[model samples]
Target: MAAVIDERPHYRPARGIHPLHAVLLAATIPLFLGGLLSDYAYYSTFDIQWSNFAAWLIAGGMVFTGLAVLSSLIDLARARGRRKQALLTFVLLLVTFALGLVNSFVHARDAYGSMPDGLILSVIVTVAAILATWVGFSSLRVGVTP
Candidate 1:
């Protein structure tokens, strides 16, 4: 009897970050930065009325991105096994979301009027956004196997 040998490549489905998550991650940094700039202009320049429009628009975008991040985080948490990178990404996303909420509220309500405190919140949101983008994209390369 001759021994049989199998010669076939094992097939495995490719898994990675979801496209919606990628889109939201890509959008977060720019929106946060734009919000920061708009807030700066609104607070710094005394006669700039148009800055308020830009600020509000950016704030709305941030809130939308925050919701997307939360959705992605819930998906990550539901996955089986230990996903350290994904968990880290989720934490970063949470931070970004929280900061985004605060920033949006401040911008929408024009809280603190023209005071520089709003600018401070904008700066924090920008930093959190930057970190979230960095972690979220880096985790994409790691890939998740479902």
Candidate 2:
């Protein structure tokens, strides 16, 4: 009698950050920064008109980025089994989202100088978003096969 050998491929789960998440992070960071810079220029110069289009673009990017980060957080939680980190990321994401909303509504008055509060809020949100993104991305685990 001849011995039979089973040759079955082992199933490997998908790992690491999703490509979509990475792309979204890459895109959102620039858009968010650009919009803030444009805002600063408009405020500092007092001569240049800030484009509403840019503001809208920033808002959209923030929304998308928030969603992407949330997705990544869920993935990280599952892969790394770190619920605390995920929870903190979620809180930061919410803060960023709220700040973005406030930024969109508050407009700089042309006659008056730039609003210091708005600028400060924007800076805060930008930093928080970046931090959250870094944390979420770092927690992801890449699957390697040798």
Candidate 3:
């Protein structure tokens, strides 16, 4: 039993980050930003409505990404040497979702420029992400402690 448990490692087939993950990440950022811009400035300045499209795209992308992140988190926890990546990915995805929620309100603002909403959100996300990454990396080094 011990020999089997400690045998030389061999690669096992499994799913990893697919190409679609990158596509989703790329699409979400621009879509959410554009949505906020249109809601706050573009529509007011010009007679147009782009928010509906941007909002839909951003929402769909984030929902898909959130699920993917959760799946990867589970896989990473089970796979050797992949846990840190998984935890960080989960945290980052969460931060993106948080920012998206904030941006949704920012778009509703009448005086968007006067407020530093974007900067504040960036700082909040950055701090939260840094903490999450630190905890995750440290756990990887320490192993799963009881």
Candidate 4:
């Protein structure tokens, strides 16, 4: 076989987020999702412990989300360009964090009282968390435009 000429354009080096930051961002999804699941279990079974589990899970998710938001901010500040896209992901994370906080509060109420509202908030927060994670990860590239 004849050797073929290979050619490619050189581009700027890729920069990426810290591994820990990525872990924190990834962790937010499952915890929030778990909270949503727990809330649903409580709703369907009327078992109070499930709500308690949801509260704790929400609290954990908030912690991870808060860290992820801060880390993303640092990453955003360091990177030039792509502000609009990054900002959208950042906003989604912020919304998820805020809703998770509120959900935690709702879960603090008496088991019966926290029901529908807590369940609803859990759903919202979980969706937001997933959106945030998806946008953040999907939009990031090593050395290319997102």
Candidate 3: tens digits of C-alpha lDDT, residues 34-132: 445544443455423444544454466456546545644664567555666666667776776676566545534544342356435434533443443
lDDT tens digits, residue span 110-136, model 2: 333335555665677678778767765
* Maximum-lDDT candidate: 4
Per TM-score, what order, best first? 4, 1, 2, 3
Q: What local distance difference test score does each model get?
A: 0.67, 0.62, 0.49, 0.84
Residue-wise lDDT of candidate 1 within 19-44, one digit each (tens)? 87778777777777777777777776
- Residue 17 in model 1: shift from native, Å? 1.7
Ranking by lDDT: 4, 1, 2, 3
Candidate 2 runs further than 4 Å off: 1-14, 51-54, 69-80, 108-114, 144-146
Please list all clashing residue pairs in model 1, or write none if there are none: none
Of candidate 4, the 10-residue stretch with the lowest lDDT total is 1-10
lDDT of 1: 0.67
Against the true structure, whose TM-score is highest?
4
**Which regions of candidate 4 deviate over 4 angstroms?**
1-10
TM-score of each: 0.74, 0.70, 0.49, 0.88
lDDT (Cα, tens digit) per residue for candidate 4, span 31-105:
998999999999999988898899899999999999989988877787576677578778999898888888888
